[model samples]
Target: MRLVIAQCTVDYVGRLTAHLPSARRLLLVKADGSVSIHADDRAYKPLNWMSPPCWTTENTEGPTPVWVVENKAGEQLRITLEDVEHDSVHELGVDPGLVKDGVEAHLQVLLAEHVELLGVGYTLVRREYMTAIGPVDLLCRDEQGRSVAVEVKRRGEIDGVEQLTRYLDLLNRDSLIAPVSGIFAAQQIKPQARTLATDRGIRCVTLDYDQMRGLDSDEYRLF
Candidate 1:
């Protein structure tokens, strides 16, 4: 992975156009082929980024060097560098991946056991279904045999949805399952997350943690 802190200007030209004026910012170039620019204030969000399966080239011969990042989808991120404060590369090896919290772990198990709750005739393909990025919580098939990737979270928030979105992007790239859908499941879902999921065509299901595990009180039972 390469990290660069530079005084630069940025322009994103694609479905939408955005620009960032000359300023000192942190730039990241990951071994996975992803590139992102970050501001000092934001926690995790990048000012702009180009997801993997893209190409990046740097032109440093002139007074003002520039970096051009392009993807197959025709989107481009242009970074014009005025001054470089810091630049370094690191070899961070194999990642162990995220460990599920207690509630999240339980939710994954219960969802895997009752896959049909996601959709009629849905059958569990596997839990921790591996992808290039990370393991999907649950992989399933709908009534029509369409692929569905589910991400289980204790609390569904924007970051969770973003994680699921990345998984969906990678999962849909498989030729055998070139059109995989996604389901974001959690005990409680935030409004912003739900809105983003809906806009992305990913379904959202609120899990009833106790009821699904047969732990709900008797008075709450319908029968």
Candidate 2:
């Protein structure tokens, strides 16, 4: 199945009923003879349309939300729950692990660039920091005597900010370093997470895959 964002428009009924800012129009074309329009980004509600036999809905319980349906000619259609609530790009069926890998790889490049851009001396303490809570992506120290912990996420996984915050708290309590700082790096951040980071004065950086892979090594003097 291939999911594409066709366009975005003001959904008056959705705006009035659900109050979402804009309704993103999505087109899902399957290798089979099934095609669908996902609206409102929610999966709990059954899909009811004017055309009978053209669509039928079925709900099922599992690790992820599952909606099974059949088309006019009895073609099977499966809509995972995450598809409606979260961006389909982040769905399990999608390349979520690949996205995470891409984000982490990009973060490594950004860390090197940040040190050069700010003209500050820094050292990477650990690339992947393992802890009781979980693995923190990057741990570094800056010239200004500050310990920095960075957590990175891809475009779809902006929820990493909270996880980074928790790691920051742990680092402050467990490490000898004073005035520990946190960095949240991602391809994109959710509005709520971005607002929270700004309010807390956390350093946030956004990096796309291309930016990560294209770091200029010769421009920076490495100590």
Candidate 3:
């Protein structure tokens, strides 16, 4: 990644803006060795750079230090208090697919363990299995000959309900499996969606981040 510098401005009242000029400039450098100056406030927050220590140190009547130098290999760039205002900007430009892949991986492990813990006689049929409907995350069969479709969403938003609903619809339409039941698992669930799901008799479960991360070794047996 190449280093470049760009300019930015701050309007929001926060730790980074308490000392610097409200309308100061910021320098932004792209990884591809390109530089652009942005006067817009929205463009700065996503940069993922920490606010310079000068703002905090100066506020306490400490020494007014010089600019901070961040060295990457042989390249060095000096970042001032004003430049650190946009540290989170880089995350905004990340690939959405990479985020999805990570969420899916975590969900796969959790779902497997959850099934075993329930002591339900179920068989893990497929993972990330492609069907006429789409790519179903996990497809399993309970001992009672009922097909269970599980979809995992990391963020646990209400949107996951709609997604699972679609999968259910596809399963019914395609006649993929008989007596199908769907489970939508996430870290959290929207209140309204939870009510709606309950009313509709939909099986929506909430699994926290820690629970997903703590699956036992036997959980990997499905893989």
Candidate 3 stretches with Cα past 4 Å from truth are 1-101, 218-223
Question: lDDT at 147 for candidate 3?
Answer: 85
Best-to-worst order by lDDT is 1, 2, 3
lDDT of 3 by residue, 103-161 (tens): 66776666764565323687787777555435667888877867888777766555566
Candidate 1 residue runs with Cα over 4 Å from true position: 215-223
Winner by lDDT: 1
- Tens-digit lDDT string for candidate 1 (111-177): 7877877766989999999987779999999999999999999999999998998888788779898
lDDT (Cα atoms) of all candidates against the true structure: 0.89, 0.54, 0.52
Task: Estimate TM-scores for all models.
Answer: 0.93, 0.47, 0.48
Backbone N/Cα/C clashes per model:
0, 1, 16
Q: List the residue pairs that clash in candidate 1.
A: none
CA shift of 72, model 3, Å: 62
In angstroms, what RMSD does candidate 2 have relative to the true structure?
14.4
**Ten contiguous residues minimizing lDDT sum, candidate 3:** 51-60
Please give, for residues 23-105, the per-residue lDDT of candidate 2 as tens digits.
44464544332345557646622132111233434355565444455544454444444334324433334222223565566
Quality of model 2 by C-alpha lDDT: 0.54
Candidate 3, position 140, lDDT: 81
Candidate 1 matches the true fold with a TM-score of 0.93
